[model samples]
Target: MTRRTLMAAGSMGLALVAAPRALARRADSHRERVEDLIARMTLQEKAGQLTLFNDPFRWRPGNVNPGDFDTDQEKTAQQIRDGHVGALFNGIGAEQARYAQRLALEESRLGIPMLFAADIIHGLRTTFPVPLGEAASWDLDLAERTARAAAAEGGASGIHQTYAPMVDVARDQRWGRVVEGAGEDVLLNKLFAAARTRGFQGDDLADPLSLLATPKHFAAYGAAEAGLDYNTTDMSEQTLRGVHLPPFQSAFEAGALCTMSAFNDLNGVPTSGNHWLLTEVLRDEWGFTGFVVSDYTSERELIAHGFAEDDRDAARIALTAGVDMSMQSGIYLAHIPDLVESGDVAMEVLDRAVRRVLMTKAALGLFDNPYRGADPEVERRVVGSPAHRDLAREAGRKSVVLLKNENKLLPLPKAGKRIALIGPFGADRSNVFGPWSIFADREMGVTFEEGFRAALTDASLLTVVKGSDVEAPLDGGIEAAVAAARDADVVVLAVGESHNMSAEAQSRVNIVLPAPQQALAEAVAAVGKPVVVLLKTGRALELSGAVKDAGAIMVTWFLGSEEGAAAADVIFGDHAPIGRLPISFSHYSGQQPYYYSRKATGRPELPEESEYKARFRETSNTALYPFGHGLGYAPVSYGEIVLGSETLPWDGELTASVSVTNTGDRPVDEVVQLYVRDRVASLTQPERLLKAFQRVTLAPGETVEAAFTLTRQDLLFIGRDMAPTVEPGWFDLWLAPNAQGGPHTQFRLVR
Candidate 1:
């Protein structure tokens, strides 16, 4: 049939079968037709369609082509024509995506559609707070709903995919990817993952606003050695499936259609080529029918990990192991055909992956209208809309953790305080926008200067001093800044890494604040002024000196463009800073991956010679501030816990409840946490494990109750068989401010 004839026929079918979908099918036969098309494709062709891609942003800086493509435009053209290169990433935006996709539909022999995807992590055009910041909000429902807006805006931008809901558990503050994930609690991660996935993907994949939300890095990429991105992941298989996979499982049950492999290896097997992880566990065990994509260049990196001999071997191992998309490994594009012909890889493997990919695209209506993503609708509604911005702002506020508020030093009277805003982050719009913030507008970022102006009026008379640069030295401005601090009532010392300082491949041997800035803050603090230290960093930086010296410390884990105003509102007492720390603030780098929920060592060191404890010469086992620690202007006190039952069996349930009251004068919010200690187990357990937590707000002198229903699932650990199951034992349940329970109460469950 001629192209015009096919177009007319397709449009006719579209009118009758245009799936404005809910519970009804436009036609069950459409899926079958897609299946038939998949059946007709060759192994190489199918694998090609399953090849995943990122947008142009992953390209090294100033690489004119966006990504590090060497004659890649032409390669893309050939791949599309060959019915290969199924997914696209890292383009300039929607229009660029549309133009690039034409190479697939018009020139490709099969006329199969290409999927356009982007890293719509926080917001599209209107940036939201980073995921870590959003986690601080303790508003899972809101965060998720905001994600819905993100999907709508992203979808409106002609994008059908988002690499989001990065639910990796960041136990180590040094891991750069921590900025992309929810914090260290299993329950929190589950809730955040569900909300974010539902928001990004929407209720139905067929909805244009609903991009295929992919939960990624398959396993823990957050617990990298020294908290570096794409570093080695070493964990027992039992621990892997227990703490890490729960969030992913939650995402899957919520309808995540895609999974991305990690750049790291699990137990010496690279995730991109680990069948035990990709197929047996994620797919076969969990029933994740979605196509799995390798992380950028991961399949090829198999050589680096010593898992594969070369690119050709990597392709064979990856496909055989169950990767649907190569994701720029070039392994598939380079050696898949040879492998298939050599009988090293099966054609059926490629075909199966292709079937899944094409099925999703067909569901997305890519075949009926290949350019469906790049419509004027997306441009009109998605980029920089108020709704999107509001979502981002809310996410940012939620993520901001109030680390200190002793003496009620916060909620500074917005009307009367002579606030002196110092430090580099105070006026930087760039630092607030973390890595993977593609669609967020950089220029519109709210700096601390803007935040102060918005929070405090002309009556407050806010003064500015560039005390110390968060990115670089002040060029000898410290003396002048200290002078400014002495004259002001409050000095807001804004500091942290530069915007580009803590992202991917930006690992550091040291996590201290820059020497110049640290010295500057010390000088300013010596002036005897009350200072609020606002940190704008991607990864956690050492804060022992600052914590010991500053009147207040706030872990602003890189709030986005709207941060200035939101932070101002919280700091100056307009809004109480109720947010809690998502990750711990270690006193020293020796703590490396220090977190509350960590496995205890077999030898469990004693404080022999006083040097055997988990302490460094420079700092203590104690973090500058502990995990789950945060401050509010008004004080909150917890009442005695009332357990529904003191003891329970493995199959039985335990109910833990407590009453919390806002004891101090203004209204305040408190996060009541539940932690447990397994008296004994087959393997070791964390010194303390966070079980349940709830964020509650009460007016001054007002009291409220918080409760949690605990089941066998809540007590589960990865068994020797690698199945998630609970052990038979007595458990100590502790309800307190941090993971460490204030007093021990016994609960028993026998398997």
Candidate 2:
């Protein structure tokens, strides 16, 4: 097993170019050039192509690195020059990126171009709402637009790839990374995954404004036990296929060129070393041609998982198991070359990994011009540009979920009113970008006070008070808040978890309003004035006390750079709150691992009979705010669930329609959700599974019929045999607002 073996294997695709104009006509195809380059590479160079290193001095908080390690800049530079580092993360600016890339292309032996990657989860310079918040918008187009804006900023900054659109279906609120993904619905996860993927890569990877989207963490990282990060995940094959794997499949289908393996093990096998996941499912079944990169040091962590003997074993297990690239660990660089030569790892494996890297760089148009968009001027012009910020503001506006607006307390008057804005987040400039926004400048973000002042007319008066810290009470803060509430005609209480509280390694045992904030809320509510609770949070929190009883409540999940502006837009009635709960909000932390889709049990709790019927004595089993739950300024009503036919042929489709009318004076945008339940099947099915949804707008007193056509594919589920199959059976359907309850109908799937 050697370079000769690779060259011989790919000889048919290679064409020789003479020296006369070798530079101009070196190759006609990427395959030819990549194969030729592989042929000329040493084992170390091939291993280097599989290694991804971090920028030592440029590391920032919130960046994804599993372990703390020391680095020497000069040593790393020499490694890049010696072809021992293939890619770099931490996202150096355009100027620095150009310098490092020049070192690799001009100084390295093979002159291979290196890739630059960052975790652009939501946005780059112009930060947008976190992915979980954005999912609440239920606007695929907006999701795509935000991702496009992120790609534009990142590409201009010389970032060739982004580890983003975390498609994992996060079900547990305690999982800090839950804020990084779309909620528990498989359909929404798939839709958003596809949308963000397309947005990141656009239609052409060669486009300078496009970025390579890496959908991760591959396969059930979200299902970690106890909602803990990097914890073991064990599940039945059916659950794995049915619940966790579809979004990754959707992202790959949407043209994601790269993927990162999860840190956690799946059913006892680490994903970074899971042959069944990376090879059998991803490559052989789904036909994902992109290379698989291990999550930061995940390859090395295999040893800690007891799945490998040492670093060498970790390298062998991961690479042979189909992990193409190793991030940060340097385990691949340390052991891959030796493993390849020792007959422990095949030469074809090494060549395949190197080839994938080369092909990706080729797709990014790096070989044609390694300095793709590596211009300081371009970076300055595109990063945090006015257009990108406007898109962010629009995204922020859409991400707001009006959880409780009793008696229509929201859409407050914008003129001739005294308003009081209180709480820690009121005028705070920091923590607005949420997690994974390492590049955002906090100073540029808009605060709640700023937004309120800007939104108010000249005749209106605005007062601000920092009622309390996030987790502790401020001295006389509650009194000041109460005083401000008494003085103003309306009160806006802003509070919740800071950016750090809901991000990686920041999981909490209990998700509730801090005691001090709750006290502040209570004090403000006691003032007996109209109150609006601006809930700035990431995950679905367990609500209690005054915060829960506030007249109006909005989940404004850390709306990025324009957080203030967007909040103001919704608060002042310039824009309606359009976000719905992507994940369900439980009444208590005791209800762990909650989701809308659940299988029926023999001892199910009945609505009327709660005694000894698998019911909790202290609380109901339903979510406080169910999935897809949200309210707008205007009132909307659903007419009825209408089906075109009582029966659906196995090979044909069925149509379901619901007439939605805006009854209130203002316009209403409604998300018409279509859910289906297989009444009887070989394997137990969820009570209801979301199959389709549409967002429609209706003017005052206007009605619109929202229709969804379902094919056999929509009914297909993993059956007893562990294969996707649609069984002939009666199915219950719901045309609803949310997952809990809606207008229902039934249809038989006739075989």
Candidate 3:
């Protein structure tokens, strides 16, 4: 397709299937019906429709955790009966969801169907790798399939919407929620955002197996200051629009049904009360028609943010700012009516919010079948099934990134080599399924010992040692670990953060290996056996000490249920490690907001120049391992990048091609990355920006020509006046394996 056609398609929702005339007519009828229902709703009912709360009572057997439910059961039931409750979240299973839906439909006077929502971030029951690990795969299709599986399982369990596909372009590793997002690159984040949305919603929302996808923490929550969660974000308008907003745009265009507002304030206005971000940018400019829900208690937290005086003020601000629903915050139900009655908040704003909420319910077919996804038999059949586990295993294998492999220590011989598996995660099963896997059964995950035994013909060839606790002192266990390594032909040191270390509210000031694990690595390395460091982490960490000096290092970021099996596959050469780093690994923890795509400075530190200018006094100002860097067993070589022409008209396309050859005995998949830099522009640009990339699998001695077509639209950036446009400029381009540096060529755009 032409560039114009592609842009137009994107704007018009390319992810959606073209509906038949009959379906379109039916949708119009549904809209008319929704409007009629809205007209019938009282102000109290309307306020209730914008209120979503957790199920107050725990109905599941043997577990009685009183979540965000109302303490007074009679009052809660009365509220449901009066049509004063819109939806229920954190409801456990099909039975609980059915009970809640029954109360809304059968007990309520208006009989409005309630939407069920949950934080199904990665998986429901059949867990896959955490989202950051999935992004590391760099496989859009795999990411989509993983989402599809999660959606199916979640749907079977009676979930109508998932607060997922967190498209926040996370640049800081210290940000605790990095595990919940795609890494720092905008294009990759955009692609995965769309893919996950399509996977969750499928071809039609009416499909029972599909659920609404929520791309969240709406604005720039990922760029929180000092890598702190919910911290203030201060940046230029250009940076906000250029770096953070594209993923949300992509997700919305890909048919996301809803969005969750961020907790942090952009500039001085909290996202829950930022009308410019929600209405101006999201609705007016991007044409997003979906409803926006506040993050958990975010609307009420606006008071804490000092943006609002009280709950009543918070409700008015958030409602006016374009939030349709309050998640777990009863401020909307308590205060919106008073605000609307006093004319402090417009009646039309309340009506618009209710309309959006009901529209989503209508689209999900909840109005027609309130219990669409609440099927116990389907839940039992689908959740954690054999087929789902296979997919999890496949995803885990693809997510493994080989950061270093000196002397070809990896793809270890499976038969004769005696392996010593040592670390906190050596025989541990629970920590493998990382954070946000709330519903996953820990016992179901494959442990490291289990995986090694499955890969080897004889289980006797492996000696397992606990070594030391993840963060605890070495004590005397390091001696035992060293002795085991001495007896074995090779040592595989499994080390990194525990499952609770890298998720929400789990931020770390020091992003390095735990002292005990580092000490164990040193002791194991002292034994003289080749050491392979298997890192199971959620975010990037500073590779230092003996862990960095190990013969091989593979980052297996919380690979979910099949982590052990997946690691075994790569270690045994069953699968090549093709995954690339979605985020850059900083050399030290002090580089809080480091990424590859920073704007060029006038006095930039160049390798050829002296150290006096813009250089760090103690450390090198570069990522330890740059973004898109990964290694496989087979070696691949890249020829120089070739441009179709040195200069082109502003509206025309420039074709860039490069030949990549696999010069090893084994076939391998190579991720050919294309980067571009605007040499001069009205506004300064990143030194290099990833524009296009292709993953190609090649056999021994096989060379493939990878080409990309770039148009003026691809080079568009936010200018001085905060308008996006492509300016006439000389553009330097690169075709390489990673984002650090490679062969370069230049092209120009002319008016």
Candidate 4:
């Protein structure tokens, strides 16, 4: 169905209004329960439900570090008793959550339940690969399974809601938060968003194993200027609707219970106070019934953003804009009631926001049993279980993308060869889990040395050397690394940014290996040993210097707890590297906003033509590694692309098929990607846009046909008039492994 149609249909169970009275009554009771609670609440109590704050007692057990603990805990406790706080975030354990929930249930006048939330972005205790790494796998089922495991662990920990599945379609690597989202493609982001939402919420929110899924940074937070986090965003409405908003729509359609508003301002309007985005687009147009929460201090930041006069104005604007909850801002708590009483903020608006928050609590069975998922026994049995760890290992393994395999240098022999693992990440344990892994036990992750030794025939065959500290020069580090490389039969150089280098507020202007590490890589490569580069990073980097010329290059994004084991599995040929790049790797840091689906420029720089037109003086126009690019043990070749018909009716289906053959000695899973382009349009179109993709596993010498069906709606675009339209025109289609050149064909759409 079209977005409009889907929006009009609303969420699941809303249709029960027309069903049998018994079923309808059950659905009606949810709303009735929320209404009844609101009736008993004072204006202050109602405002409290729209406010959320961090847990005061979230510090590690027995450690109780002074500065880490909330100093205003006494005041906060009184507020909870007075029904002035709706939710608590960063509640570490079930016991802690239960303690806070008890304050509201037993001590408060209304006995309302308080919601607990946390940033379970990738995983909870048993960390999985970062979101970008998982996206590289291009395996939707695996992504869903990982999300499910995260939800299970989170639910057991008394986390009623998880701020996760950041579905922002990020194209720039310099954006630090890119690690939290799926990469550049809209379709890929949409599919992963939907799958993750389903995994987090499951079939029912009332289930004890389920946690409320929140697809966050509601709109266009990923397209920050110069790839800086929380930077200003300026784009046409067409681009916003076509590119940035689809994933959010997909997540909502998949039954997401909440959305987190972005910190960035779009077109001079802070997202927290942008009524067009939070209300008109999210609620009225897209029919998202879920509550919208402001990003950390985002409502208060509206003053900093120059969009509001003060804290009171910020609260009023955000409330009117449809932001139901103010995260850690205290704007809603401090000023919401006065605004409501003074008639600056309407009572209906406050009630609407309060109702939405209460409905979510009811859906989670928090009203019936606030501690439904907060069981100590369940926490002990499920959190970081052996089964979850195994899944993490598999997820990490699949996320590793073989970027360059020169002369088949990978799948190193398990015996005979002396392997030297050199670089900062060689034996690093803490950095493997990456960022936003708040609850993960760093000690649980296997070190590279441990994993490699386990995979080797003899433990003595491997020697590990910490070549240098990340971004820091270590005295004599390069010399020690070079000596180790010279003594070994081959060298595995583990290098890339540390976890902190690519998360919130960590944007880098130079997205290349640090100078010290670049120097270290060159020194080791000079030893003449076959060097394999295992790049452990959260975001795409400009691979240059000696590292780019290594015999093999693998992009192993922070593969969470099983990083070491997963890397060893792929290196030792226990598993084939099948991941494809979801984002393009630029050759130069100057290519900050580079992507494969760029619009056709007026002065196009065709590879086959002269370099005088739209050409860069220092670098080529192409990406270092294009989107969907990767290699496996076996080589897969694409056959001729065949279309069922040369012409398709406006409302009819067009089937496109291609035969893929595994031409090597081993089995391989290949991602068959399909791209389409409009030959002519009122508004110029992208050179090619990703339309369809599927992963197929084929045995040696096996050929399989993969087909994709496209309806006229698939070609729809936001036209110059700012409405979706599919003009009758000629179109070009290509089937390939990546965004690079491939076999092409042409077709037409006719009315």
For residue 567, what is the lDDT in candidate 4?
90
Q: After superposing candidate 4, which stretches have Cα over 4 Å from the reference?
A: 1-27, 58-71
lDDT of 2: 0.85
Task: Give the range of the ten consecutive residues with the poorest summed lDDT in model 2.
Answer: 6-15
Worst lDDT 10-window in candidate 1? 6-15
User: Global lDDT of each model?
Assistant: 0.72, 0.85, 0.85, 0.86
TM-score, per-candidate, Cα-based: 0.90, 0.95, 0.95, 0.95
Name the candidate that leads on lDDT.
Answer: 4
Considering TM-score, which of the candidate structures 2 and 4 is the better prediction for this target?
4
In model 4, the number of clashes is 0
Candidate 1 regions exceeding 4 Å error are 1-31, 42-44, 52-75, 92-98, 101-103, 600-620, 649-651, 741-743
Q: Candidate 1, 675: how far from true, in Å?
A: 1.5
lDDT of candidate 2 over 1-751, digit per residue (tens): 1222211221111112221122113223577889999999999999999999887534344534556544677888899999999998875588888888888988999999889988888887789999999999988889999999999998998888999889999988899998999989887898799889989988667677889899999989999999988899999998998888878777776778789999999999999999999998888777666789998889999999999999999999999999999998899999988998899999998898888778778777788878986898988889889998889899999999998888988898888788898999999988788988888877779988888888888534888999899989989998888889999998888889998899998778888888888889888888899888898888999888778888999999989999999999999999998888899998889888888898778788888888877657888779999999999889889988888899999888787899999999998889887788898888888888887677888899999998777767777788766677878989999989999978999999998
Candidate 1 vs candidate 2, lDDT winner: 2
